[model samples]
Target: MKFIHIDKENSIAFYQQIMSSIEKAIKEKKLLRNDKLPSVNKICIEHKISRDTVLLAYEKLKKKGVVKSIRAKGYYVRTEDFNFDERYFLLFDELNIFKEDLLNSFLKGLAGKVQVDTFFHHFDPAMFSKLISDNMGNYSKYIILAANVEGVESSIARLPKNDVYIIDQMRNSLKIYSGIYQNFVENIYTAMESVLDLLQKYNRYILIFPGHKEPYDMVTGFEKFCREHGKNYSVIPDLKNFKLRKGQVFLIPNDRQLVETIEKCNHHHLVIGEDIGIISYNETPLKKVVQNGITTLSTDFSEMGKKLAQMVLKNERKLIENKCTLNLRKSL
Candidate 1:
């Protein structure tokens, strides 16, 4: 009954205004399935607008499956699913500040073309399988962060193979599908190599790796780099009961341990960047401000998000490895 009085003074095209109003109404639930719309002729007369203008709007809506018309029954709401063209199921290993950056960048890149429902598997294989199995047909597409979980290959096999894309971690068993992934082995190796000069300043290099949650490839890479360079290095499970010594640089893979290392430095009265050095994995905003700055070996997560969005929209099937970078600062 209203095009909301088509304002000739406004810059928006009259037909588009009508389309927006209808779409807005559908989103707000003001119009639902089978709700009748004003007849084309009635809109033409009541709004003193051209029949062609009203027809253009209705035809567009019809094409999008938002509205339909019968030979004599006039137009009616076909569906109220106008908010998005598609729905996405996003599964992450866990929600962290860096992961939040990736999610935000992804949503921005998507530009509202689809609705996203995010979930976390927390690196639990059973939970990962259950979530995917339970939401088998709920979403149009599934983007998963496989983490280091086991049996993911079998779990994802039940899904529509073509509609799934792997995110973050990539495994040999799950290589059949497409995705954006991080090459942790090469990333860690190259990242440390990039800072070889800075590392030489310390007498020994140690990586604080707690077997759980961290990829084994990271240890492999760290060991490879250290061994090949003939540098003194050790990979220990954790910093528990560990001694803080001068001329030592700790390569911390997890944030919690990174904090613990820093606390150890404080407890032992060791001055970071002077008596002790630290290099942590993954970049966060606080890393730049904490301890003057924390040297980080990380992948460009925002770029990964943007590229993943493009991959989904374009249906690109290539295995993409996000670029990694080393942020050198006072912490190292």
Candidate 2:
């Protein structure tokens, strides 16, 4: 790890400064690939800062593929690959159940020598632009899990035609080329209708747990449906605050949280949302957790992955404009 001074006075954050410096160092060959970074404790002592600072810097580098963390070891500078081949780039906002399902599905049936790069972030436009510039050309096709960006679509519009396809979350405005996008509105409505049906059987107040602040298709859809149906629903961030109403339905985001929450809900008879009714948006291990079988809105990740690979390999850009489908399950 290279020794350095992280600026704290600049409008840019201290962690961001650390990241910028590290990135520059990597670009200038100051930090060689596979070079182990300074340990969190060491960096904190050297910089006379907190562990959070080091963690933030490490996180940024990890996200950019500039650095990686070894289990039980510290962060290390990532070496760039010399050989280039046709690949499908998978960019995501975060790692969670939704992302897991997408990756599992997309990785399905992928055979051959091809590189897959998966980046996760809820990045600003500038950060995303940098990421695109840094990584886009390396892969033949860009499979983006759109996060919240101020003007992501417009920025993507400037990229080479047929290079980018989106899934689940859309980072920018909707106006770019053919790519996979989730029908958030419709999917949520479907999930909610299923919830309502189950609620009719066993009355309960529905409390919606949103993981983050970014706009979510399922959450929006749930909210809209609740409004239209006059069903009681509240969008709460934390489950501890949820007020359970007798016979009221709660539309929690994923099975884990739902399970955790329901367990705490005085053993309320909760329904797991899988693909069919009250389905969870991003499918993964939670599918098995819902003993009653999770009703989920599963993504065709494998199909999308294969299609994206074909687009890149065959130079079929028009297919980038495709929208994704929801795989329904039976929670509701």
Candidate 3:
């Protein structure tokens, strides 16, 4: 490994400075294809920087196809020439099973003609702004999942309007942007209507909504459903210290809460689908087997990803609403 210099006083980010140094080496023929680079720990120790900084730099290099990593070994130069026809910046709130489906489908739809670098904000406003600002002008397109984050319109405004696409949840501030999103309010309200007959068996409807990580429209829809139907309902932050009783149907959005609710039911010796009911938000393969199949009202994530790909490929600017469906299983 060659000596790499990092300037701590410079305005450039530490990871970016490291990336620039490596790219400069490769361009100037100092680093060749198949050449092994210094280990992350070694770089961190030599430069007196955190391991995360070095790892971030290496990860970015790997994403750009300038390097590759071998299991139990280290990073190596993958190619001398670095060029991509269509580079994309994909930003998401977080990764889950349904989101993974969407991501895989989006990749499949691209057909190997595009390079996509994905990042997660995890619903942090500052991190969301930083990620967008850091990657501006570097990618051909930006696909963002603005999941209930406030004041992100300014960050998104920095990108080229024609090259940006929003996904998952769309806010009024982001209405000018073209993307695919779910109408959570309408979807939830309609889904409840579809299963109104089954819901009548329960005495009250309880929704476990930890608001920080969930869509507010879901709460609105739940409230609207109860109000219009004249059904007794209550919204709680979580299932913590809450007692589960018979004749109460629970609408759970987060999977962790769904599991907790099921366990609470079991602890009380209450049978699912009979004594207490459950309806989860997103559908996954595991959901089909958990508790003899948990019922779900979910949007078609795979379809959303495919539509997004189409919009990007054709340069179409349209606000498309992906469809949602209710899957009635034994849990309901």
Candidate 4:
């Protein structure tokens, strides 16, 4: 492998420059399929750059199906016939089963004309800022799941405003950007109202909301519902040290807490739906069978993903609220 000099004065990013160099080599028939690329350490030392810079470039190549990594051996050229219409930078907070559904829907809706590179920040504001800043001008589109993190507006503003689209939860500071988000406050309040009659059967409604992981607006919505309807409600951070009482309905967001709630109910020999009710946050295939179908208040993640793909395909700049539904199952 030839060592290309790292040009400090060039407008192009270091990783992108590396990517282009390799791509050019492949196109010119200089680098053939199954050719072993230089090791990350070799590239870093030769170019006087950090390991992460080389790794990022190589990772992008791998995502484009240009290279494949062999365990302990290093990366090898996978193919030279690389073709893609558009490249997308998808940034999510984390991946869950429901999120997997959303991602797959988005990919299917695009029909493989575009190549997507997905990354996760895990709700870290600093990491989110760094990822966005590092990949500033690489992709044609940037789809982000902003979650509820603060101090991200400035970082988001640094991107091409017209090319950015926010997904999942939307922050107020990022309102100017195109987004498909769940109206947490409204969704929860309205969902509760829809099941007002069933809720009246319970003695008290308890929302197990750990503010750090769960959205605060959900708390707001739950509070608003309880206040307007004059229902007895209490907000607890988690199910730690929680005791199950008969005729008490629980609203759980986290799956771990949901399991704990169900286990605790079983310990007390309390029957779900009749003795106590449960309303899970997001719906999944497992939720349909667990405890004989757990009721859920969930937004249409599939539709959200599809709409996001449409926005990217048509280059439409719009704010969309993906619809949410109350799935009343046996748990309710």
Residue 16 in candidate 1 has what lDDT?
A: 88
> Candidate 3: worst 10 consecutive residues by lDDT?
78-87
Which prediction has more favorable lDDT, 1 or 4? 4
The lDDT for every candidate, in the order shown, is 0.85, 0.60, 0.89, 0.87
Q: Candidate 3, overall lDDT?
A: 0.89
In model 4, the Cα lDDT at residue 151 comes to 86
What digit string (tens of lDDT, one per residue) describes model 4 on residues 31-115? Answer: 9999999999998888889999999998778657787788789988888788984578999989988788899999998999998
Collision pairs in model 1: none
Candidate 2 runs further than 4 Å off: 1-88, 96-101, 104-110, 122-126, 136-139, 194-196, 202-207, 211-214, 267-280, 289-291, 318-332
Per-residue error for 307 in candidate 2, Å, reads 3.1
Model 2 C-alpha lDDT per residue in residues 1-332, reported as the tens digit of each score? 46566766678777877877776776777778898777889878877889997797776555445676777987787755423234556777777655565577566535545557777656556767767766643445677765655566655665566666666554335535556555666766765566454545434345455555345655677778878887656666666656554444455555566566546543654333321124444566656455555545555655665565555556555533334344444555
Pick the winner on TM-score between candidates 3 and 4.
4
**Candidate 3, 2-56: lDDT as tens digits:** 6477988998999998988898899889999999999999998888999999998
Q: Order of all candidates by TM-score, from best down to worst?
A: 4, 3, 1, 2
Tell me the alpha-carbon RMSD of every candidate: 9.7, 14.2, 10.9, 8.2
Query: Candidate 3, which segments miss by more than 4 Å at Cα?
Result: 1-80
Q: Measured by TM-score, how close is model 2 to the native structure? A: 0.59
- Which numbered prediction scores highest in lDDT against the true structure? 3
Tens-digit lDDT track of model 1 for 117-151: 89999988889988987666556689998888777
Error of 2 at 7 (Å): 54
Top TM-score model: 4
